[model samples]
Target chain A: MKKMGKERPGQPGMDRRDFLIRLAKAGATVGVAAGVGYFLHDPFGPRASAEKPPGVLPDFIVPGVGKKIAIATGGGRIKAIDGAIEALGGMGSFIKKGDRVLMKVNCAFASPPSLCATTSPELVAEVTRLCFRAGAASVAVTDNPINDPESCFSLSGIGEAARSSGAELILPRESLFTEFTAPGSSLIRDWPVFTGAFTGVTKLIGICPVKDHHRSGASMAMKNWYGFIGGRRNIFHQNIHTFIKDLALMIKPTLVILDGTFTMVSNGPTGGSLSDLKKTETMIASTDQVAADSAGARLLGKTAKDLPFIMQAERAGVGTADFESLKPYRVSIG
Target chain B: MRRAGVLETCIGVFLLTLLAVIAGGVYWYGANPPKSASGRGPGVSGVPLGVAANLPADLAPFGREETFDPGTLSDKIDGKADLYLSTGFVELTVRRFAKKTDAKSWIELSVYQMRDSAGAFSVYSLQKRKDSKPLNLASSGGGDSAYRTADAIFFAAGPKYFEITSSAPGLMGDMKILAINLVKGQPRSGGLTIESFFPHKFLDRSTISLHMKDVFSMSGLDRVYTAVYTDRGCQVTAFISRRKSPKEAEDIAAAYGKFLLENGGVAAGEMIDAPGAKIYKVFDTYEVVMHRGAFFAGAHEVDKLESAKDVALRVYRKISEVVR
Candidate 1:
């Protein structure tokens, strides 16, 4: 063990908090190395490609892959989840062991599996299990439920699913929020947020249900981050598109998973009527929140142009809108 | 008889033409009243006197009286004491300017020392009350000076008791008279005798503002003092209390600067040129202020805690003088 006073090469006056963050990152890096599947590399720079063919690229630009999404389905079940995952390499491709993994699942409504108001419990569980298997040291599954958390989690089956999948459920409460200063932001400067276990964590994954929203037209990946903010949620509703865009800039999630298996056609992030459900038989996964939401919007037969938040998120560089670069991999499941 | 017949004929001829034109003019006037008449008042045609004669003489003070008797007033009348709901999420209280029929004498300003359950009297309302109607003047535009009510009371003895009241709604329980004075003469009418004094010089390190704490959220300085300054004389004289340690007082002095710089009270560059002075520490303090200069050879330690306190007071007085 290194002495506490022995500072890292570049650190100056590193306090206990900084030391802990670095220690966690180091532990995660070592654990990922031991897992020996895919490797974690800094995403801020151009990544060196693995010894794989062009057809089975280890990585694709996050924004490019999000625009058009595809979930493999065959014989009424998922046949190639691992194949789709392998296409972009493996879990090790993005995350490392000991990384604080925060999964944002859709628990917006108190409806059963068939209602489509929330992401299907099966999809959420699969994502949770995959993240744990990927060497995530700590997995925290959370969502800001519009309905009561207990009812929403139970009826949507997310609570049980997250538990069984080895993910801790983080209920949205004021106690979980912490103050963050966003410099240069006009509407919000110092605001309170739940701070998706991501700040010091190695990776952040957005697991959101594709649904229609009253204010911004669509509640997709970018809008999902709004749940993390507390104190003044109503202020965001005043100008939702700008708020969503600003939130996307703030969140900067590592990956986006659009649970399009059952898309809410209307009256959501909380839907009630039976006619509001639409079965897309698809799951959109990408690194770009904008592109993932754009594809999710398209699943509902709505264009990115129709969803103002998506356009704003895209304009803010949260994702891309151009369908050509989306690079969708439509796989068949069993 | 011939002259009377001619006069009758002229009157009849004039009446016939005038009647035809008068009817049209009256119709036009009915449709549009002249704009000048509309501009004279609120044009509502009713005195908005608000709640009339319902409030107890003690709580509402309907007529001019030496003292208010709370027992006679209504217990919980709606909108008591003529507090008008104002725009911008605020309400304004009514203090009928103590109508002194005599021109020479002004009403005495009275600072009500509201007594809490403990019986200690303070000028401000420390707690939130639901519906108690005490003799409190409500106000809006949430600024409170440290001794503004005190000063208002100080100058009230002369003649014009600026019918002062708390800036909050509802009653303030039982209140006793703390201090009384008239502000000599109306400062507006060549009467500028009323002055604030602070014995210390360092107290002027920060800008002083007279405002309420809860309303402004502890953002502004609520310090008050008075002193006359000459063009060539030192303006930085300050005072402090004897109780606190010199080091502690110095830290307190630095706190004023910290607050000013950190909380947008004053620009960092602006503090360099502000002047300083030394004086005896007591109830109030004074300081000399310079908008663009240095002071006290870079804020050193003075002799005693009292001296330090005096400096703090002086700083406050200097700031108050500059602000005033």
Candidate 2:
């Protein structure tokens, strides 16, 4: 209301001194903000947890006779799995009396069991029966499948096998996942692991199929542990070999079963047609996941060298790449 | 009274802008709350995926009809997601259907929608099953690239590739019905492609592969179609790629030869049938590479050099016929 740059009596219009004070206050506010921002800014977004948790998954390796391996040929899953286990000193050697066992099966897809996209229900049912036969107190069938856990479990025929075999079906829920980070590991950074399934569980067994993986070249025993991983896990496929090696380190399974009754020779991990399958007619079981996958590679018409994960896992000392060195007991089941 | 200084005025303006931004943030946060990442699981819709798929009569939906986007494609198909993503993958919808007559017998139908029909065919032909019988697709009104397996049918129509797989051996009829319905509904498409340039005689159509990038680990080789041939008990694979200019095609051809050499392939000699053709023996297999006009063509991974040269000559002749 006053003329420009003119002062009014008792109005106390903005003076140079007041302007300087206001400027100082404003400058101080911005400076403090900039200082705070400069001090707290994380240029590299979020990183792997400050400290790696000590022993994420329990080392379920049995005291002695842990690295045993067995290969069975020419049979259905029921006979093949049983023969392979028998050659590994039977379920008693791993699942003891009063032990609570967890079977991590590859029920990643909602496809039918016959498709070989998931573990065969016959194999799971037989394994559950053998676990009970070995005097296990409780056995849980669990997998954080890529699809809806319930749908994957139900459509893959694993749910009925679990329920019918008196095994608890542990479906992965939000509450079940625990953020995990492995020491000296990459790609598995503060990732959600289905840790709840391991609660009160003693022995762990991974049952997987021998199939071609478009990214990793093969989905074998070591790849089965992927089901234990949760939360936007597709990102791990970017570095699948290292991720599989990390999985090998994360889950030191008491045993791993490689189902190759019918091997997915091509278009795998999720082969959509029957022609993608070939009758390899073999099954492998081992305490050494690397060795199991090495033996299982033949089913995919490849060798350990063909799949980089096998070599990675071997280099990580998860198991021996020369599966034959284990002197795998060869069994035949009709 | 004093006029506002330039430094204070600029600071005042910035402060006002910051205040406005804060207000906008408050409004935005009030309107849209943070979502919980933990709650995200499987289905893309509010309802379960099993009931979301559209199906025809005589076949009932078996389970959720799941879908995966470019970001989530790896969730559905695992490692195979890269194959589709590299070839312009858009969306992948997977649904299973059971024969109403026999509930236990079911087939999984996965339809991968690509950016274009070429991308679709690239995926379809790339993963074409070995030893499969190429379907005339007579059941699907013809013109569709399809094949039949013991328990399934795979086809590419327009910008979508369809894979109908069944565990039951006798569900081929059910799969065919599904394929026909899907093919008819897909967008209009161009028939064949550069793939038609390959000699059909003795060529295994089902074994034809279309690699979008880094064919045989050669970065310069892209959008290549390789078809296998079985002649006189000898199995050979032939490759073809079309470029915009003849110079580009020739460069790519020579580059592939260089790539082979860098990867332990030795230059053996040249083929008399095709001028400027380079031959290489890699490990136990033979490779022949050449270009004609804007077409980059070759024969690959032949056990015998005789078969490799013969197939390369045939491919060169075929390209010449098409280029002119």
- How far off is each candidate at the interface, as Cα RMSD in Å? 34.3, 3.8
- Per-residue lDDT for B1-324 in model 2, tens only? 356779879998999999889979977985665321223333556222233343446677665556677877776777887889899998877767787888778878777889988888888887877777877664555436888877778888888887888857787776766666666546656735776788988897777777888889877568888888986779999998888899999999888998899999999999887989999999999999999999888888899999898888988998888778
What's the residue-level lDDT of B284 in candidate 1?
38
For candidate 2, write residues A1-334 as lDDT tens digits. 4333876685457666776777898899999989987997778764446565644678788998758888899877788888889988888988889999999999888777777989988888899999999999999998887566777788789999999999999998879887788766877777778888999999998887889888888998888888888877887888889999988988888888888999998888888666778888899898888888898888777899998998988888888999889898999876
Against the hidden reference, what TM-scores do the models get? 0.40, 0.86
Candidate 2 Cα errors over 4 Å, as ranges: A1-41, A46-49, B1-55, B62-64, B99-103, B138-143, B167-170
lDDT, residue B288, candidate 1:
21
For candidate 2, list the clashing residue pairs, or say none.
B49-B64, B50-B63, B50-B64
| Per-residue lDDT over B141-188 for candidate 1, one digit per residue giving the tens place of the 0 to 100 score | 111211232112211121122233221222212111221112212222
Error of 2 at A294 (Å): 1.7
- Candidate number 2, chain A TM-score: 0.88
> CA lDDT of each candidate?
0.46, 0.82
Lowest-sum lDDT 10-residue window in model 1 chain A: A51-60
